[model samples]
Target: MKALVIDDSRVMRKIVGGILVDAGFEVVEAENGQDALDRMAEHDDIGLCCIDWNMPIMTGFEFVVEVRKHAEWRDVTLMMVTTEGEQDQIVRALAAGAHEYVIKPFTPEVILDKLQFLGLVEIEETV
Candidate 1:
């Protein structure tokens, strides 16, 4: 599956991208929300998007709102990978149509498990 990782931090982006890649997903990188939107416009194969809450040019919340407004992108699973741990932030993200949330300082296992919960990750045989 194609997954988009949106974050301003190059390190964080690489980390998340690696996790998704290890999970058997084809990864796409976006520096921020606007960049993510541009990618979405060009790629209809994007099945999942992992966006950071705080970003320049456009915030994750704003991106979520914009994506939710469009019918064509409605089937794409949206996930917020952010440092915002407030209950309000969680509620707001869910209300804005995010499929899942993962706070920062997260491990690859946590992200993998969450993706499994969302049914975005396929079960693979162990070697």
Candidate 2:
């Protein structure tokens, strides 16, 4: 699967993209919501998106809302990977169409676990 990682911070985008790349996904990076939308247009095979809430051009929440408006993008799973850890913020993001929420400072394992839960990725059984 291909995953788009959207964040204004270059370090954050690289961090999230690296995590997805490690999880067997082709990764793409976008600086903000508008950039993410542009990336989506450029890549039709994007199956997942990792979004950061606060950005310059467009917010991740706004992106989620905008994506939800497009029926064609329904198959794409949206996950908010941001530092907005407030309970209300999580609820709002979910209400806006985010499939999963991951507060920033998260470990790779946490991301993998969320992806597994969303059925976007599978885990192997240990003998």
Candidate 3:
């Protein structure tokens, strides 16, 4: 499946994208929420989005709200991957339509685990 990695930091985008790529997803990138929206519009097959909370042009919360307003995006899973670890912010994102949340400085394992929980990925049993 395709995944969109959205963050203001180029390095963060690369890190998230690399993780998704390793997990067998075709990854697309966006520098911020507006760019993400544009990319999503262009790619109808995107199944997942990893969004950062704060961004220029549009914030991740705004992005989630905008996406949830459209029935076409209903099947797309939204995951917030950001430095905002406060409980209220987490609650807000979930209420706004994020399916999962991951704080920054997370390992690839954490991301993969969340994706698996969301059913966006199948976990391979390790020997």
Clash counts per candidate, in order, are 0, 0, 0
| lDDT (Cα atoms) of all candidates against the true structure | 0.93, 0.92, 0.94
Pick the TM-score winner: 3
What is candidate 1's lDDT per residue for 6-100, written digit by digit as tens? 99999999999999998888999999999999999988999999999999999999999999999999999999999999999999999999999
CA error at residue 45 for candidate 2, angstroms: 0.7
Error of 1 at 85 (Å): 0.5
lDDT by residue for model 2 (1-127), tens: 8999999999998888888888899999999999999899899999999999999989999999998998889999999998899999999999889999999799988899899889888875546
> Which one wins by TM-score: 1 or 2?
2
Cα-based TM-score, every candidate: 0.95, 0.96, 0.97
* Over 4 Å off, model 2: 125-127
What ranges in model 3 sit over 4 Å off?
none
**How big is the positional error of residue 101 in model 3, measured in Å on the Cα after superposition?**
0.3
Q: Which of the two, 2 or 3, has more TM-score?
A: 3
How far off is residue 125 in model 2, in Å?
A: 4.2
User: In model 3, what are the clashing residue pairs, if there are any?
Assistant: none
